[model samples]
Target: MSTAPKTSIIPREVDALKACTQGATYEGVIMPEDLPRLAAAVVSIQREMTGKVRFFRDESNYRMVTAELHTVVSVQCQRCLSALDYQLRAEMDLAIVVSEGQLESLPKEFEGWLLDESGSADLYEAIEEELLLALPIVSYHDQADCSASGQYSTGDFEEPLAEKKNPFAVLGDLKLAGKADSTDKESE
Candidate 1:
């Protein structure tokens, strides 16, 4: 079956009211370079990310957006310090708010997106934030895939540690030996 060609360039910013009124839906591929914040977090992006964002007025008359994003990115495995491919998916429901005051009034079901001074919301920023929140705080390959998986420990090692000597004990021994030598010299 034929599918409609999706736009590759989504506008970075959009007028929230206009989009909501028109019920605009944008489906597209966002280039890796286009998301600087996300790029900085990962080692590299495997390919262009695909996403769909719908803007509409909710039942409560709140201008809202729902975004679904998917991508594969490369990040360093914290365990082995090697590159690992990570599958990232993010979804967000945000209500467009013009000010912080409006945020408090936002329904529990929706998060607030404070509009810029220009009275527009930044779709790119919102998308990036969602992806960032979705990322693993610390990434690691599965034990089968990780080179350093079994090398870390918080308990005693399998092999016993060498016996440790205290410096003060050695000094006490020297003092005793010196006293012996002094006594011997006085006898002489």
Candidate 2:
């Protein structure tokens, strides 16, 4: 195992950006093992995404990181109640900040952190946060493609019929008719 940090472009030292100076750019891939928290979060949802990160910094102490991710995710169709696979494409942008306090003490709006005092920045946390934030709150597979088998077809199913019984009808006949009706609908 390489003891070196797995992120490709993180600087070893933290540098202060002057008000009028141009910031630096860092690019790299976040190895899966390097992001345990993030990996766990995604894996818990049973999805896998991998991609590259590009971070740009400005002299005004502002930083922006963009990530392009691709993965296959498992989702249940809301309309069909069936499991399906979905192709996920996600893009995210995050602002970065450098501070000297404990990471927990930082303001809520500070999107990410630069933890070192050596004039370089490590972007592992920032990248992880950005990717997580970009995940969709809800995702579903294409409905058209999901129902080809028609066995688990949602389109053919009707809304639950009202429970009111026909007062004049015989109870046994109604029960049998209801069952036959349901089966006939399924066959259609």
Candidate 3:
């Protein structure tokens, strides 16, 4: 395996096959502004993302890549709708595949990354996808720190109980009327 010199600027495009053959390692900081897709998903980014990506041929002779990323982003709390700083740490182990058919053949331990026709993959896309996956399904600050804590309730908070009609009641009535009309015609 070859060790690549660390660089500050992360390349947007990466030749996965060539990197795998050369056993290249890439590490850098990515500005939040540069990731439009990730920026749009959050309230704001608290800091730049730091990441490392390494490409190499695995023992099974599969072209493989592993990526690790860390970042902090601002996301609205589901409970209070207030901004909360959420730390995201993501790691990925994937086999580089040139076509969709190869995905099904990948080993269970490795997910597949399909390279486009350009023969290179988008470095930012890989990082962004993992980071997005790392985001919490529901974001919230600690109970002690959250302003809207201690207000959770399982019961309804609506006004005093009022009679509610069943949505299917009209259909039931129509059926009853149809039965009554049939009975009347038979009696006639």
TM of each candidate vs. truth:
0.78, 0.44, 0.75
The prediction achieving the highest TM-score against the true structure is 1
TM-score for candidate 3, please give it.
0.75
User: What's the number of clashes in each of the models?
Assistant: 0, 7, 0
Is 2 or 3 the stronger prediction by TM-score?
3
Residue 32 error for model 2, in Å? 1.9
| Top lDDT model | 1
Query: In candidate 1, which residue ranges exceed 4 Å CA deviation?
Result: 1-7, 154-188
- TM value for model 2: 0.44
Write the residue-wise lDDT of candidate 1 on 102-123 in tens digits: 9898778778888865668778
Sort order, lDDT high to low:
1, 3, 2
In order, what lDDT does every prediction score? Answer: 0.88, 0.54, 0.88
lDDT of 2 by residue, 145-185 (tens): 65544556545768898899877669888899999999999
At residue 168, what lDDT does model 1 achieve? 93
| Candidate 2 lDDT trough over 10 residues, lowest sum | 11-20
